[model samples]
Target chain A: MKNMTMGLAALALLAVSGVAQGADDDHRLDDAWKAAVEDNEGVLSPAQVSGLNILAYESAVARLCDGIKLDEKKFAASVAAVVTGGSALSEEEQVQRLTAVMFQLGTANGLFLAEGAMKKDTFCAHAAEEKADKDNPHNWQ
Target chain B: MKFSRTGLACMLSFGLLALPPLHSPSHAGKTADAIAAGLVGAAIVAAASRHHKHHKRMYYDSYEPYPDNGYDTYWNNVYSPAAGITCYRAQVACYKANGHFSAKWTRMQFADGE
Candidate 1:
């Protein structure tokens, strides 16, 4: 009877510890999600808002390999590379770097959409180039 | 034969001189060889005087993911993102891997209400 009682007490202690750890994780997830939005404010287009929100949720996953951790090196490199790939040009080097970052965020969001877990809203911004050309005939000349 | 009319007088004299002596045919062949060498030298000099030239066009990487039109080439000139806190913050951390935050995170946040 005494041994069973001891086991029950230990089980209770472990359950409490598990709950505490889960709460800590929830806090981190919230922090990471806020960080993602904070990092990506004006950059995400209206179409990508949905994807970012989804990734924002993934930030909550406690495991490293599973979701996009706002604080991991691999994620950072991937972000930098995507940004480098999507980077825009600017007269100011600093401004140019920011442009590159926009590309990174946009491209990253696009990738997450491709994963099949997230559905993207069709944004008209994709047609900006077409509209610009349609409106300006002299552009081709 | 209109030797004079054809202006072969000087050429005929040279030919006669070029002929091997009736006594030594070998000497006649030597003179013909010298005349042939002189003509070849003149041809070589003419060819060396002429020249050939060429020009190459310029090419560059396309900035567009997939270009729909000709203007795609020019897009690379302006490839950059909007200057934001995230970029500034990320770059700071890039310089120093761990939390060496030079650029404040709040400074670059998107102005759009999230």
Candidate 2:
């Protein structure tokens, strides 16, 4: 009876710690996003910044969820079109701009995936709900 | 006539040389016409290839999913649940308004929503 009681207490402790850790991770992500916005202020438009966030979240879902696939080529082409101003920008300018945007996206994606890994069950549930929604555009197929 | 072998050879050579040159003015004109025709064909092919390439580039530029006309704010806002709409739906509306809907966009909208 004592051993069973001890086991239950340990499980409860672990569950509380997991919840606390998840909250901490969420805060970290929030701070990281705020920092990203501050760092890119004036350099990137608000839309571009928001696009990066959306891309990161979708990428995380795509990576961790089953039956979801990202069309990387099409996504990259669309991103290139936007960054290059519909191919109006010079090659050098496009390269510079794309590099910057990709770096930001990479950072955000890394953070999102790291956080998602910790609470995979919850994250994937949310991801599945989002994917099932007809109106969501990230298009994880 | 019983001509010698050497004499026969010389006559044949002279007879061959006496005929009109293969590149007569008329023949040269025909050759030039062929060359001109070939050039025109090549030019047409090149122009068609260029047009195809330009059309592809324009298609990408036109159909890509970037926000315009202040839709960027909407895009940013939709990420939050407070917006009461998913980003995907917002994007569909945005693309439709801007006439940027491609076949893929059309299919997605048809499969998912009105």
Candidate 3:
């Protein structure tokens, strides 16, 4: 009976400690995000907002994949609050900008992969043509 | 026929060598090779320009997600939930006139890795 009582007490202590650790981690993430926003003068450009949004989404996906719990709303809310500061863009407009930039960057990366994949000769030829084009003064502007 | 053409070109060049040069190659005229290269370059430039125009048109056409009817349902259903917090909060701030949206719980799908 004494041993049983001691085990229960130990389990209860562990549970409490686990909860405390989780709370601390959450607080740390919150503070880190807040600091990141403040460093940007609380005004996030479309690209910056898109970057943070992508990071949050990727982190959430990773957590989901790992079967770990995530308070996605907390992270999302922090990012949104930062991006919204000192911005005249409507919420929809802001979201559209973020999405558009993400799509554009993704498309560029996809094009690079498609153009350069598995064929060094083709890639080199294209790179040379691009370089020759870059040599033109008018092309620079 | 290929050998005859080559022979004729060689004889022609040798015959032209008897005359005084009227102009340097740079000032005279474009060679067949240069002309062919120019045509290929022009075709490539045209194709690339057309492709870029098409891409630009496609992007501009789809840039705006919401019409005059608004994106309330889309905001509530598709985007807010899919994008989760940052977008959800921005949606709230930007569309205060559109009324409130409920916070959505994150849905995890392990089977298909969605």
Candidate 4:
């Protein structure tokens, strides 16, 4: 019984550590994106950077929500916060948070399309899949 | 689209106004300097306007009626070889009332202009 309990605890620790490592990787990727964009001669201002970020968010949301009715003002505000807030949140987290907010807003306001228009994939999951596919590159456009 | 004659005249006037401050030293020159500053401001605005026109002009040639999960759509004529995206913004009220999704169009240049 003692050995079995110890084994279970060890397995739980391993699972927690794996989750932490995945989160750390996400933070690293976010940092890389930030470093690449910051001080880039092409970007005229921080607001432009924010605009690019919002465009990307829109692309992901379009796929996830399909024909769902989107609230533009709310979406823009959430994206602006992520861009200008200077928070240490990972890019993945930022996308997920925005998705959650939109989901709640859509549900409350009856913004979702008819039953047939919904998508099963989450924004974060879609992003991860895109990142892994080297043949299809991601960019501001 | 070609720049309008009015825009050209305005630009020329601004250019003329910008020249006097470079040579004259009279008290009227001070006023010319202010005019020159204003001309520079106006020139900047004019240039920005022209740039906006030069960018892409995307619109839906056709799209499926809204509440349809699939957007079977085609883009309007390509004004330039410049790359841009056409995304459908969900405005249920607009769609429900008018049978069209709000076209979220932007005139943007892709990196490498491809």
TM-score of each model, in listed order: 0.19, 0.42, 0.20, 0.21
lDDT of 3 at B34: 31
Give the per-residue lDDT digits (tens) of candidate 3, residues A25-61.
Answer: 2112322232222212112233343333333333322
For model 4, what is the alpha-carbon lDDT of residue B75?
14
User: What are the per-residue Cα lDDT tens digits for candidate 4 across A1-141?
Assistant: 999999999998886554322222211222233223221211122233233333333443444554542344444443333223313434333222222222222231222222113323433334444334565333212
Error in Å for residue B109 of model 4: 37
lDDT against the true structure, per candidate, is 0.26, 0.42, 0.29, 0.29
RMSD list, candidates in order: 32.8, 26.1, 25.9, 23.2
Model 4: which docking level applies?
A: incorrect
**Order of models, best TM-score first:** 2, 4, 3, 1
Worst 10 residues of 3 chain A by lDDT: A35-44
Going through the candidates in order, what is the number of backbone clashes in each?
Answer: 15, 3, 1, 0
> Comparing 1 and 3 by DockQ, which wins?
3
The two-chain DockQ for each candidate, comma-separated, is 0.01, 0.01, 0.01, 0.02
Residue A109's lDDT within candidate 4 is: 24
- What residue pairs clash in candidate 3, if any at all? A76-B86
- Cα lDDT tens digits, model 1, B29-107, are 5434433333342222222222211100000131112122422222112111332111221111100112111112211
Per-residue lDDT tens digits for candidate 2, residues B52-112, read 5332221222222222243333224322111221223322211221111122233333332
